[model samples]
Target: DFRPHDEHYVQNFVLVTHGLLMRIFCMCYFRWTVLEFDQVWNPQNCEIWVLEKTKKGRYRLAGSWQEESKSFGPIKFGADKTKLLYPHMKESTPARDMVPGKPGWLDDPALRHLVVAAQFGKGIGVNKELGSLG
Candidate 1:
């Protein structure tokens, strides 16, 4: 039960299975944006797609580098076309993380590879699940 602006609109939904720790996020858009459009659907703007992890174990939205404030971590792009990393970034706070090494959580080879691959738009033998928009 996830809604962007209003709960009644119900633009997206997320469900998680307790036992398996499996999670699924489904987005219903009024119009298809570049980020969600696929060839098969051919939907003008209204469409829905589920963002899931690849077989390689990387989440769908992982590894999209974006500008961030010096204080906070990486800035993330929002559905409303807004950049959201640090809600309260200010001049006094640091602009970015200057450490050389990658984040400790992403030390795994598979994760690093996936990040590199996604950044370059190169397929890494991973398949995306596609479903009907209607």
Candidate 2:
């Protein structure tokens, strides 16, 4: 089952995605601002720990997904949160015609197809029984 998405989580993911796209892929020419002003994330339950697989397909801590290739996580918060980083992120070619921008952008139906791409792979686990700082 899918985790119930918190809007806070979704919004911040957009911020990270946009930032990554800008610095790495140059898909956008805009600044870090979500719309007009920047969206300052809250540093509570939003801490993100990136988990990656090795070349041999073994699970390993990737240190950080790296917000625009900058060092700041394994567990990130506030301006660094990024739990949803997934496949093709570095290679995500934003459709020139369908980048996010609308009254209710998160609820946009056209981009719904991107949801699976953002989901954590089946390898990710939670709790001590699985793997977590807790």
Against the true structure, candidate 1 has what lDDT?
0.27
* C-alpha lDDT values of all predictions: 0.27, 0.32
The residue-level lDDT of candidate 1 at 28 comes to: 24
How well is each residue in 1-134 modelled by candidate 2, as lDDT tens digits?
22348444331122344433323322132112221112122333333434343555333434344557666453231223554322222222335343343333334343332333213323322232222211
lDDT of 1 by residue, 27-121 (tens): 12112122322211221232222233456533342222223522323222333324331222211222223222334433433223223323333
> Which model scores highest in TM-score?
2
**Stretches > 4 Å off in candidate 1:** 1-44, 50-105, 122-134
Model 2 residue runs over 4 Å out of place are 1-82, 92-94, 99-110, 113-134
